[model samples]
Target: MDFYTVLSRYYDLVFQKNKKALSMIKHLVEIDDHTSLLDLGAGTGEEAIDLAFEGYHVIAADLNED
Candidate 1:
């Protein structure tokens, strides 16, 4: 199965799935104005977009596909 294709659908699901934990972490990282996130092997960009919406400068990296 093409993992990226499958992952794309569940991308937002992950965030919503872990909403409570993420909210806790966000409170932990309650620091300065400029924050950054690196979504390694970022699949359909859902996580990266979410981080950006939360005021993080996201660096989404992934391998190219056909």
Candidate 2:
């Protein structure tokens, strides 16, 4: 398999629990339906998913397909 394909399978294992940072960011930033977020280096899309759920338009970008 390619490097990203292999890493995708395990990326969540290491970064899933790192979502606490998202909460801090949310508190610091004010986002409404008109606001959009561009998440650079969005690893496994955990934050992107959360932001979408909260109703922000999110663009998740990463070097890896994962």
Candidate 3:
């Protein structure tokens, strides 16, 4: 496996969502019918999940496909 593939497995253990960033994004976007966001390099998609939970359309992708 490659470095990112290995890192994907332990990503959640080593990192958690950045609450401040999440808040800032929400504050800036102000979810609406047309509101959408893309989270590139979104390892484990924790941030995307958070935004999605708040009813924002979010697309998350990562280099590591595992």
Judging by TM-score against the true structure, name the best candidate.
3
Using alpha carbons, what is the TM-score of model 1?
0.54
Span of 10 residues, lowest total lDDT, candidate 3: 1-10
Worst 10 residues of 2 by lDDT: 13-22
Model 2, range 3-58, lDDT digits (tens) per residue? Answer: 77888888888667456777886887788757888989999888889878877789
lDDT of 3 by residue, 1-66 (tens): 788777777899888888999989988888889988999989889999989999999999987787
Residues 1-66, model 1: lDDT tens digits? 687666666665664544564577577765356776676766556556766777777788877341
Model 2's alpha-carbon lDDT is 0.81
Q: What is the lDDT for 54 in model 2?
A: 78
For candidate 3, the TM-score is: 0.92
Pick by lDDT: 2 or 3, better one:
3
lDDT by candidate, in order shown: 0.64, 0.81, 0.90
Pick by TM-score: 2 or 3, better one: 3
Best by lDDT: 3
